[model samples]
Target: MKQFQNNSLYYDVDVKIIKQSEHCIFYEMRNDEGKGSIKSYQVFPGIKLTYNDFHMGQCPYHNPLHKDILEINHCREGRFECNFINGMYTYLGEGDLAVNTMVNNRIIDSTFPLEHYHGVSILIDLEDAAKMISPILKDISIDLYILRDKLCAGDRCFIIRAKNSIQHIFSELYTIPDEVKYGYFKLKVLELLLFLSIIDTSEQFEKRTYFQKNQVNKIKQIKQFLTQHIEYHFTLKELSKRFDISLNSMNSCFKAVYGIPIYAYIRTYRMQVAASMLLQSQYSITVIAGNVGYENSSKFASAFKAVMHISPSTYRKSH
Candidate 1:
């Protein structure tokens, strides 16, 4: 096994895509064990994004070294964990943007939720990016070198919430038409960088975790247990007590690890289970709902429609 220090950051991260279109390239990402159906996208030169469904059950951390570039990651659907080399943990929740600059000294790895994690990543090549923006910032006292220093000099990762400006940018990226995505992506990428550069960096940083490893292992266990038991009901208090952790600790750590709260994860997993049952089993809708922990068929139907975007019967008929 090669040590992370010697490995290329882009190595092993290059997904093999069997399909290609004008705007997006589709690829499948497998686990270390080599049994996977995880599908992701490679958006041109530097951006890689994934629109995952119920996949990626065991994705190990990636700490590869890459050329100097800044990665702007956004969490649109479920959550994902982005960990820096210095022990700081940043959870990209829904509508959250994580700004990380890739450095040779500091490698990184990220874990997506067990299911339903959709996000976009835009990588700006340091040389090309600086050339485009440094002149623009000449009158302003800000330079790409300064921003680069702040991002990579020490332990810093800028975590921005989903405000209107950020939201609108991602919204366009998410829904950009296929014919225009190639050019539109370039424009949007630059637009987003300018937005980030202008933002007041004073309050854009959050220092939450410097992980101990064992605690993170416990949280991973929590995710594994909940995903396996889709029929069971879980509460924060019950889980925290059962796991010998404080409620706040459980909440924050779970968010940090899984990108959403415990209950929200449970709910998403429940709907996924129901979806599979609808397609695979001969059971009626009422029985299927009860099997996934819902007593009232109507309520189960509502929740299923909310997550899967169709009623049980409709889904069953289609699939």
Candidate 2:
């Protein structure tokens, strides 16, 4: 475990080493919230690719800023939340790519707004990675230092929302044959860096949504209220007045934080609860629909089918 701490990938976080082989290391962290595991592979010297699968709400990471390290993250599922030193909150939804170096932007901690996140992080020690640039490709050149400067110029952290180029690069990584995993990862990492190197920073960046601390807090309160009282429906105006936030701000901030609008989130949430009731409890479809805020069984059946893709009776019977 102590030896693994020296790895730039886990240097700042306190992770227990579960096991390690010649080229890969497995680490796990568990607390009251939940458990998570990180499987890291040494793709290249001073360059490592880590697969992060977390089932907890938050993971505490010490702010051990390393200027030589450049971090690239891709959110494959769920939502990633982090507050920067500037007191602003940023999020990464599915298919989003975030590039930042600790020197320019410091990540205070790792948080999953949805309580579970699956993603990938590529950690590059600029100095070390530069020294090990493979000579296998004669026509292509990769300079880690130059890449960092280009992407994280000044205090900027380059972010790209879901795009076809990003999708093309990372989608295959999630599903690779084990026999070719190591070799496949090297190819993908090189492809990603190459893509970043040539990308036009001015036109390719996404307009990232940054929320104020107060707004985030209030929206969280709104979310808690809505989830707790799923039996009732609230309009955007009603929630705005109840939470004392502007209408536009409420809609955008809620979408930014939770990756969905308030109504969509609550609708999915209600169906989820109703789903559990259908399976766990001996409740009638009408009773279950009423519990989730539907007065008319026909209307509830329509909404449930729209969300779950099956009628309530059929869903219950299928299981």
Listed in order, each prediction's TM-score against the native is 0.71, 0.92
- After superposing all C-alphas onto the true structure, candidate 2 shows an RMSD in angstroms of 2.3
RMSD of each candidate relative to the true structure = 5.9, 2.3
Cα shift from native, residue 78, model 1 (Å) = 3.5
What shift in Å separates residue 274 of candidate 1 from its native position after superposition? 2.6
Best by lDDT: 2
Clashes of each: 2, 0
Question: Which residue runs of candidate 1 sit more than 4 Å off their true CA positions?
Answer: 1-9, 17-67, 131-142, 151-153, 177-186, 207-212, 284-286, 294-319
For model 1, what is the error of residue 222's alpha carbon versus the real structure, in angstroms, after optimal superposition? 1.8
On residues 72-119, what C-alpha lDDT tens digit does candidate 2 reach at each position? 999999999878778788889999999888764366666898999998
Indicate the TM-score of model 2: 0.92
Report clash pairs, candidate 1: 9-64, 9-65
